[model samples]
Target: MSAETPPGASFPESPDPDRTIEHRTPQPGQATANDAHTRQLPYGQAEELGFNAPDGTEGAPAKRGRGWLLAAISAIVVVILGGGGVWAFSQLSGGGTQPQEVLPGNAIAYVRLDLDPAANQKLALLTIARKFPGIKDSLSDDDPRKALFEAIKGDSPDLAKVDYAKDVEPWLGDRAGLAVLSSGAGKEPDVAAAVQVKDEAAARDGIAKLAPGDEYGLAFRDGYAILAKTQAAADGYAKAAPLSQNAQFSDDTSAVGEPGVMSFWMDLGELADMSGAAATAAPTALESIKDMRFAGALRFDGDYAELTGITRGGAANTLKGQPVKIAELPASTVGAISLSGLGDGFATQWPKIQQAAEATPDGQTITKSLEQFQQLYGISVPDDIVTLLGKSLTIALDQEGLDAQQPNVGAVLTTDPVKAQAVVTKLEALLAGSGTPLQLAKKPGDGQLVVASTQTYADKLGTKGTLGESESFKLAVPDADAANYAVYVDLDKLEPLYLSGLKGEEKSNVQVLRAIGLSGNYTDGTSMTLRVLFN
Candidate 1:
């Protein structure tokens, strides 16, 4: 049984402060001088009132009581409301004003690859997974494709939906496309249905010639049906598939490699295609993610911690420590999803139809590239790794006090023991008495380590680098670690580490790999790829 309900909800009225004040006593003997003075003071003494009197006005005490009451009520309201507001905000937003930190190392970016049955008859994607990084060298008899083939072919229905194409399109462009078949079909039907009907006279003739057996849907399987009966009702089915398999998937799937292969012999034209697509996608993707707030953080050693404070776009500094903590952070808006899910989200919405291939076909190549990207570079960037790449600290010997004994030294210098204690001796004699101040700065041959180029430079060096490339340079100066006075070596150091071939390869081998997952196979059948990122 239900109870009867009230028409409207009721709430208690706020207590009124003015109503709490009590009336005071009246003075004795009215109209006399003594009575007038007493009345003025405590509503009783006029001579003693002084400036406290309100021009001998009546009801002065009552006015004072009202003012105090109002003040008290206001204060109470402020405290109550302020505290409630803060508490309510915390409850609604999960507390705190700052977002959590995301470490790079903790993140596990995934690349999902779904093979097209018609494209490649291969029963599994193992033929393709063997070429990817980490997996290539690690694949064994127990799990030939590393975890990739199992990740795809395993009975785990949960993993089958992993989509690399969706997650990395924004950052890696069509590279994601080349790896996975994005889940959308082409704009128009690849095949259309058509039917043919025969007249009654024809049907009668065919009935007489009818023999042992006949199949009704054979033509329909191929695309259509033909009827040859006279005055007979006829029906047919027409089916359509994408003219180009690539069109069925998103752009990221287009750049993936073939099965059983690791790398591709990408020519200048192919590179141009990848680069152009990436260029167009980057700005759009960045804008989409600009408002994304992430939670989670990476912890680093003190030396690396200081580097995190350094802005991007500056010279690289060496950290004194051997290891730093990196955490993978997530945005509060969405609870944490797997690295694979993240990739799929991007592919499902990636844009770039303006430059689609005319008749692109899906193949084993795509599956391999997708697997490689996931095992190697990854999409689920952990917060810790990001921190490692984002921040760094410099260490050098501090010898300022030791140089005080020398002559005419204009300035003092400090040094860090970890980074360049050995180099400190060479400079001690020169700075002993001194021709100039012993300024600290970056040493030579140490430019390949800088991260957060643009932000770091803008904050510390008052300069910036190009966006297409993440540049790091040697800051050549007087000492091993100083903020002022440095030089850049773009061609000498940065280009070699980031843009050139492996440790021993020709300059012409400056081939680029799709960071999202697209990998290549050298002429020697060896898989090779490179990945770079910027915060």
Candidate 2:
């Protein structure tokens, strides 16, 4: 009923209720990069990538600072945009000012978004968005931001008192940012927000209009307005170090290799420290990702949008396997994923993951359960099955039997005979006596193992065809040949199947997508690219 693909993922959240920032109806989605590619996916070359077509965190903050901060800034911007002031946004591009320039250097996470980006960015956004009827209707009505402003204002009574034209427009600038300023080992993370401002005088006046007391902290720096829980915190931010000074954030940013409309970076080690203090179980599991740093960006290019991300500091696995043979997938294939390096990567890295898992009581219990199953079945699962997947593995779904009693799905695992034959023999003998034998066949000439829902598709897996040449795959995954792993969905081919399974508004939303493609290459660190192609 759905198509799945590999890809990458962002978005900021609305405010909380206790801070009088009530009503949280998130509009929908969001990010960017250019390896001439980025984000379609977090999908990997791992054998068990979660690719079911339709399938489907964190803290209270240093109290209320981050959420209330973002809420406070957005309330200001919403009022300004709703005023319908049409002065050129370029006038307030404000000498190339950015929100990060004012944020604290000790920040564990930071995210920035711009209401007004450069011309190319705006065009790229419109170009990709105009294809969706729901989104396009609003954007096409005139100044797109005004439509956005109205939607954001919605029925939230929290925004009722301020006059947009008089209170906000004359002073508001185009970009804003939110951050977890610091995550100490034992306390909640300090959080804050920065909103750009063109006029200190009117911004101060607007603040007065929004409130009568010192409920929210506020200050000014480098053409931006800083917000915090109390006046002292806001003042401190103006004088404190900025995030640009953090070395890991800079390195991960460089690994991303390109900039886009929106950017995000976070430090997991500091977060882990904060959690480790409070957590009672499996604290070492937290240790596994404690040193990792993550960076991601989102941008729109031509007909599609991309989100790219990088992970640094955590243990990384460098892969050594051939690129996927995407071009050779059968013509009838509706969706497929081919990966070569994951077999070895899993063997090398799984123990590290399992060891961390064992640190928890529940994890230890699960480990014992797995050991018992292995001993009873005479299978060293980690060694035997992993070796059996010695070479490359490809999974394909055929459009032919989607409506039949059994869907046509097949997997072709090309393995080394010497390393896998014994495991294969063991599996065959076990299954033969188990009542429910798996649908598996073998290719003697090439030592390829085939598994499918039916014998017909199992046999058809042997024929090579041209998936890479198809327009949908080509458009979604242009760099498949160079990618160690890639997954694609021929939405145009499978749309009808999905449409019948949907109802009402979901059908309309689903119609705009033509195909989705994701491709990635991993080395010291991983970088991925994803594209959501529109009809």
| Candidate 2 lDDT by residue in tens digits, 1-535 | 0111112211113132121111111111222211222212111221221101110001121113234345544543432222222112221111266677788878888887765543334445544444544444433223333333344334545445656667667887667888885545677667778888889989878766555433788899998888887789989998888877777777777666534556788877777677554365455545546687888876555556667777777655546677777778778788888888767867876887788778666997889898997887777868886776666788889989977887889777777655565676677667976886664554433666666677788777776777778876776786778877788887878977768888765577677677788877676666577877777
lDDT of 1 by residue, 417-535 (tens): 22232333334434653665353332222221211112222122211212112221111111212222211112322332355345432232222111111111211111222112111
Give TM-scores for every candidate, taking all chains together and pairing residue i with residue i.
Answer: 0.15, 0.75
Alpha-carbon runs more than 4 Å astray in model 2: 1-95, 140-156, 211-214, 245-247, 277-290, 318-322, 349-372, 417-437, 444-447, 500-509
Which candidate has the top score in lDDT? 2
Q: How much does candidate 2 score in TM-score?
A: 0.75
Number of the predicted model whose TM-score against the real structure is largest: 2
Alpha carbon lDDT of residue 309, candidate 1?
Answer: 10
CA lDDT for candidate 2 = 0.62
Q: Report, for every candidate in turn, its global Cα lDDT versus the true structure.
A: 0.20, 0.62
